[model samples]
Target: MLHATGSKKELTRLAYYALVSDILEHADVQALKQFRHHRYTTRFQHSLNVSYYNYLLCRFFHWDAVSAARAGLLHDLYFYETNAYDRTESPGQKSHSAHHPEVAVQNAVDRFALNPLERDMIEKHMWPVTHRMPQYKESYAITFVDKYAAIVEFFGLGAQRMLSHIRRKQTV
Candidate 1:
């Protein structure tokens, strides 16, 4: 429902909502809210942040906005504590950044019917870090948006909104 740190937008009212509303309500996606991420943001919010901003960027460029939005939301689909990983990726084992895109793609394919672009976006969002080349322009949008989401969240820009969201959830 929001994007970036210290920024709030009317998400459901925007065209962006219609593109992602289908999967956003799913239990798997909602489950992201339970995992802490970016210190102050939940994975759900982080993904939403990426999704909305990516959609806007792609839309502005007259690219495939739908795929960009959908992929952004599904990009970080894996659910695990981010810091719970071996610092070094062993010969056979992958570091979390290198491994999660694969995990997320597997999880996404199992739950949703993905087009090739969506699949590419979800799988290659990590880009040079994952050493995976993106197959489409929209794929590159996700990589930027994902990083933007992380930087904003890491700096605690969205903490006030998240706190209010938590307070409202508690009241309900």
Candidate 2:
């Protein structure tokens, strides 16, 4: 069942799906399924969690929830395996945190015509860790949502795995 962090609602059945259905259908977004995030979750799932919670938060605040959701979905949209690159502190060489957003923005722009708010949110979701401050309110919303979703995806999925293992053992 597809659900977001801290919520049990099935995402597709909810109103939130309307905002991201096209982006979700794209080949580039689907490619995230191959990348692991936070150890226990796929980048696709992590992105979905970020997207959903971001949408909810932005909607509550009366911000641009559509942009928030789209940006969240595309924020980490890079292809390389997570640990494959040797991230370095060398000047002019980008760390993984600094680099992936640019790649994601480029990839997203190629497939979707993003507004400035969406662009800012995707580019600055890493916030102070990245070079610029997020210019849009929705952008700031995503930074928190991204981190929140990661923690939940990491520990929540780990717990789920443990429960599943226990269930299997009990069945035996």
Candidate 3:
């Protein structure tokens, strides 16, 4: 229903603007731009992509778009260099996928007045890897969108191409 009056691109842009308009100017959120995420993408870029995708899905399903967008944007708020982790290390000093969610949740809570849904979404985006299911629909949307964004970033797709690719995948 929401997309009926506008092109997907237009709708996505609107949703993206709604997600970032207030948070973009926040110093801590802006600092995310400096951290590297998947491949060559910055943490800010990846977060934006995830938030946008989550926003689209939330709008499509008539879910909590604001909460999904906010949680998606902060899902990877952990500030350390993720690439430094050694795969061979023990559980206590391993890859980021297992630990960053908790750290990110803590950081987000410290910086933002997050609702329970947002906190759950941020803390459980890792899903089966973390063994905790999302307690809210928006949280599930964020989890899926986060994975979608990660795959896109891993493949080095540009913004326009990423949207197109995601659209194509949605159809299949």
Candidate 4:
């Protein structure tokens, strides 16, 4: 990663290494490549979107950009297999969405040797909306950004499909 200018360079370095290491350890390259090449809406893209939103929120709040980006990127570590939802669900049962975050937190801690703050951010990113309320300011920042990104991704998927439908109609 390029060196970020100004105050939090050291902290950013620490967070960046830990988070990237965690991602590499957990994410399968074949799966990621298949998702990217097959045009699947993927955890990788989701993570990137979350990271971007976290950057925006961090800048707005004067938080550590590196830490925020790391937290966002690593928040969905257990989502290496995009079909997890399909595997866990049986016919009528609702999605097992709530479990992934805890699974992710555990995997991240074990894989990356995360510090307390980094762990907190990964663990609490689903706050208010999914999990319990976040305690730390960093956790709160992740929570805010995660939710915002989710909404944006939701609308983005809709827009993409809408445009595809329009193009299909024109072709026909």
Per-model lDDT: 0.85, 0.88, 0.76, 0.61
Off by over 4 Å in 2: 87-92, 159-172
TM-score of model 4 relative to the true fold? 0.68
Candidate 2 accuracy as lDDT = 0.88
- Estimate the overall C-alpha local distance difference test score of candidate 1: 0.85
Pairing residues by index, what is the TM-score of model 1?
A: 0.85
The candidate maximizing TM-score is 2
Quick one: ranking by TM-score, best first? 2, 1, 3, 4
Ranking by lDDT: 2, 1, 3, 4
- Residue 61 of model 4 has an lDDT of 81
Clashing pairs in 4: none
CA lDDT of 142 in candidate 4? 81
What does the lDDT read for residue 7 in candidate 3?
Answer: 35
lDDT of 2 by residue, 38-156 (tens): 89988998999899889989999999998888888999988888687644446778888877888889988988999999999989988778979988888889999998888887788
Instruction: Choose 2 or 3, whichever is better by lDDT.
Output: 2
Each prediction's RMSD over C-alphas, in Å, is 5.6, 2.6, 7.5, 6.5
1 or 3, which is superior by TM-score? 1
Per-residue accuracy of model 3 over 58-150 as CA lDDT, tens digit each = 988999888887887788887767766545557567357768899999999898889998899999898877888888888877878888778
For lDDT, candidate 1 versus 4, the one ahead is 1
Error of 2 at 109 (Å): 0.5
Please provide, for model 4 over 1-172, each residue's C-alpha lDDT reduced to its tens digit, 9 standing for 90 to 100.
3222112344335544454544534544213323431133456556655665676578678876667776676787663454656576777663445556787788666656576777788877866444566666878888776766666556666577779999999999
The C-alpha local distance difference test score for the whole of candidate 4 amounts to: 0.61
